[model samples]
Target: MSDLAYSIVTRDLSLWYGEFQALRSVSFKARNGLITALIGPSGCGKTTLLRCFNRVNERYGNVTTTGEIRLLGKNIYDEDVSLIELRKSVGMVFQRPNPLPLTVYENIVFGLHIHSPARLNASALDEAVEQALTDVGLWMDLKDKQKSKATSLSLDQQQKLCIARLLPLKPEIILMDEPCSALDVEATRQVEELMLELAGRYTIIIVTHNMAQAKRVSHECAFMLMGELIEHSRTEDLFIRPLDKRTAEYIEGRFG
Candidate 1:
């Protein structure tokens, strides 16, 4: 479904922290408006690969990277690329729920105030906040409590707020790295449900060690092992008829 208008493409992208190569010149296509899951055991470099999409890896020093990461047909590594704008379009949600200790409204408006200042007037900001929260199924939960301190909310709600904050910017893609790892079962389920609901609206790339979660949310999946992409296919095919012996073994619970 992604020949033309590819949302994100990595061409022989490789990264290394000093001498330790983390990604092995991996190349792949992440289609627009679909949920693509990255599944692998610990230390397999799935997380590292996901970070390259948003240039998050660039924040770390001594991290040398080689190759092109293209977003919406533009090479993101281009000298003139605006990291700030690029990041606004490619948002990220980390493993822990790190909502700032401010009012719920502040949590959502924080980025809007900084990223979309020209469009963040009173009425527009309110509308954007409402839409973002609504997208994550948290508007009703947080509407009345928008004035409440963000940290005072339950862990589940806090996580949702973190996600809601990302939406106001209208990002083209979302990178979630084990986003529900800290949540309880119910909260985790809610996040998973939201992801399933979000497919085809936002390009989502999530890295997870949870096989069930991967199967539950992904339309397609890429399996990785020790810094190499082992297989990429439809979720059903990957789980039901894995081509790689390692992928099959992992899915069958041979090892992580």
Candidate 2:
């Protein structure tokens, strides 16, 4: 496939935190407009690798990284690359819902206010709020509640609102770190459905501990162990016929 078909690519990418190596020469390509799930046991570097894409892991002190990471074929570590623009292009959803303690409409347009080069007028802001909420299947429910505090919403709605907030920035990729970890089964299902609906429009890379969720929502799955990428393939193939013995063992209820 063409390089343009991949939204993110890592070549011999590795990361270290002080004396601890978190990722070990990991390399993979996540195709555009598809859901790619990173799965593994706890402390397996799944979240570390996901955070590396946006360079957010650098927030922690004593972090060191080597090798290349490319987004749309451009080396992200290039000195000329702007972190603000990189973050705008790559939105992330955390394990728990963390909406800004602002009104619903404000949350939706927050990204635009911060990232948009030109000041957006009231009408443009209004349109952005509507479109963003609509994109996340929340317009009908939250239209009349624009002024309502985002923190007042239920957990599921708050999570969806957090996702909606990223829309105005027009991100090319969405990184979700155990996005549904705090949700109930029904809410998890709804979020998964939303992910599927949004799949063809954005390249989504999710770090999920739930094996079933990996099978259900992702097109491709990558398994990691001790900071190493053990296997990556179609979700069906990864679950049913993993190429690596470790992957098969992990999926078959053996040691993590």
lDDT of each: 0.87, 0.93
In the range 1-256, model 1's lDDT, one tens digit per residue, is 2344568888888889889999988887887788999998998899898888888888887888998889888899899999899889888889988899899888898987886547557887788888888998988887898899999998888887888898888888889999999999999999999988877768899999899999999988999998888899889999999999999999999999
**Per-residue lDDT for 44-158 in model 2, tens only?**
9999999999999999788999999999898999999999999999999999999999999989888988876788899989998999988889999999999999999999999
TM-score of 1: 0.95
Give the TM-scores of the predictions, in the order they appear.
0.95, 0.97
Model number with the top lDDT? 2
